[model samples]
Target: MKTERPRVAIQGIRASFHEEAALRYFGENIETVECNSFKQTFEALQNKEADYVVMAIENSIAGSILPNYSLMMSYSFPVVGEVYVPIQLHLMALPGVRFDDVKYVTSHPIAIRQCIDFFDEYPRLQIVESNDTAACAKRIRDEQLTDTVAIANALAAQLYGLDVLERRIESNKLNFTRFLILTTHENARKKTGANKASLCFQVNNEVGALAKVLNIFAHENVNMSKIQSMPVLGKRNEYNFYVDIEWGETRQFDNAIKQILKYTHNFNILGEYLKYEEDTQAPKPAPSPESTKRYITVRKIE
Candidate 1:
């Protein structure tokens, strides 16, 4: 019997970075359930409409998406895995459209922010923020807007049949977005070879309370990769600490958790999964001469 493909939910339409992350984690065989917002993706998982969810947790250029942390706490889904996608924004338009013909540029707000340096050079072009980068590209194709262009990924250009007019337009070439693979508790199983975990807890406002918890992990030889503090709702001067930790042995993590519980309240183990590591030493190609020239000329447009 043939196995049914997993239905994955993502916070954007097809050809989006969310969909790209899902494909990276689950392969191309999964079905994508598009959601207009991040909350909607969790709702899909909550309603059993999707077997899994791929959500962007952080971006190299934009920093942490704070709202996602709250969503993770609210829904309490298990993060089964993670994937980091290199973000490469391109300016695309309808076929036969020239660069000079572009009057308005549009994309997701985050995508627009990433390309601010490129847009700063051309003040004559109106910048508009839309819901999704791929959606903007689709609109350009569906409406046949010759005077408008969308700042999105190459995948969007390819899927929407739009021609890329400018490549790698993002200000930072090293941009990357980290996405988390989440699922309901019933479907979540500890990943094989798991070495990292995400946890959240609250400690007393007293001095040394927070440090005491960190010290426990340190003494256990657990490597704390990241720590973030979020304001506890309706509470004064109290915060919830979210941490990501890694270890070589599972006992180290278990022992650390046991010790920290004494100093923490409402502690929750969000998930444990294999950590994703990118090859940072890989050489990146320099921008093409044509692209450099386009940047210089576009700067003089105004």
Candidate 2:
């Protein structure tokens, strides 16, 4: 008999939301490991140290995680799954300390932006940046700095044994973070019928050029969920468009792709991912309110 387990690598500290997202995919008692940086998480998967990599691609408030998108585009790790976790930002400080005692707060830049309204209330407070919010809370507690506080999740505050000065400090009440689960295998793509096909390409800037590109999907009857455009580095007046189209197994998507390749330059296939969890009530094949993805980062190749 053999016992099976999931080896998941996530970027951030133990109590970060990425860990929670990995657990949602792998399970609670999952064999979890942490990498300090997003690139390191990708490296761990490339090195075969972990089966999967989970990291935030976009926030409802702060927009796309650009650097990670570059990694996604160049790296060959296929997206195995996706997860969306509602973010509840919290401000935690040393035990028994009042809010007035806080001088500076530390957290990830996105977290800081999400809770800008709260920070704005304390105009004199200093803001510091950290890679992970949970790690900042742990540092605040370990250093025993009552004047210092951290913006992170409630779970992080609990793990660091700090007092919550404020909860749900984000400007938007419905804020959430979306993460992508990547695997090392190139052939390991989604198997479900209702899948999303992601592809990118550079189109000539002639008259009606962009329309001609989209017409391929329109003619194939592939319902596009989202489309985003970014500049192609090192190439002037050239750009890449990332497209996600919803398709069923019975629906033929190859013809549309064939038409695209005949015209587009450096056309690349991102992945076909199975979308899940709609409204936290049911999982359906049709479009979900929160299922639009805009996560592809591009950076200079060094």
Candidate 3:
């Protein structure tokens, strides 16, 4: 009997970076349940429409997505895994559309911002912001807009049958977005190599309260990889701290958690899973001849 493919919920349509991260984590055999917003992704998982959720938590260029942190606290789902996708923005349009023929360029606001240096030189092109990078590419293809181009990924160009006008056009080549793989508590199982964990807690307002919790982790030799503070809703001067920690030994992590429970108010372990290491090297440009043709013909705007 054939095995059933895992269904993953991601915040965007097909061929999006969210989908890219999902594929990287779960592989291409999984089915993608597209969602319009991050909250919707969680809802899908909550409603049993998806087996897992791939949600972007932070970006190297734009920093942490604060709203997602609130969502995590709201739903209280377990983050079972993680994947890092390099933010490689490409310019793509209908087949046979020349570089000089492009009049308008569109993409997600964040994607557009990353490619500002490239667009700064071309004052003739109008910049339009959309909700998803892949959605922009799909619109250009579905509408057959010859004069318009989209700033998206190579996957979008391939999926929509659009030709890549320019590859790796984003201003920052080193940019990357970290996505978390989340599932319902019942479906979450500890992986064999689980060495990292995500935790959130509330500490007393008194001075040294937060420091004491940190000292426990330090005392147990658990390395705190990341710490983010989010304001408790409708509660002034109160904050929830989200922390990611890695450990060399499971006993150290267990001991740290035991000690932290004494100092924290609403301590919650979001998940315990393998940590993903980001690739520092920039992605190579697309090797297609058509993708590189614009480099020789288009004059630098400056």
lDDT of candidate 2 over 1-302, digit per residue (tens) = 11245557777766688876775565544555578788888887787666678878777777777777678887768876777788888889988999887789999888898888888888989999988888898898778988888998766776667888888898998987888888877427566664676677888988888888788878888778767778888978888787767765535587788887877888887777777565642322211112211111112111
User: What is the TM-score of candidate 2?
Assistant: 0.84
On TM-score, the stronger of 1 and 3 is: 3
Model 1 lDDT-worst window of ten: 293-302
Q: Give the distance in Å from residue 123's predicted Cα in candidate 3 to where it truly belongs.
A: 1.0
Ranking by lDDT: 3, 1, 2
Candidate 1 TM-score, true structure as reference? 0.90
Compose the digit string of candidate 3's lDDT tens values, residues 1-302: 11277778888887789877876676546667888788888888887888888999999999999999999989999999888888989999999999998999999999999999999999999998999999999999899999999999887887788998889999989998999999988888999978999999999999999999999999999999999999898999999999999999999999999989999988899999988854532333332334323221211111
How far in Å is the alpha carbon of 245 misplaced in model 1?
A: 0.7
Among all candidates shown, the one with the greatest lDDT: 3
TM-score of each: 0.90, 0.84, 0.90
Better of 1 and 3 by lDDT: 3
Question: Which residue pairs of candidate 1 clash?
Answer: none
lDDT per residue for candidate 1 within 1-302, as digits (tens), equals 11277878888787788877776676656677878789988988897778888999888878888999999999999988888889999999999999897899999898999899999998989998998998999899899999999998877787778899999999999999988999988888997878999999999999799999989989999999889899999999999998999999999998999999999999999899988865632222322334323321110000
Cα-based lDDT at residue 64, candidate 3 = 99
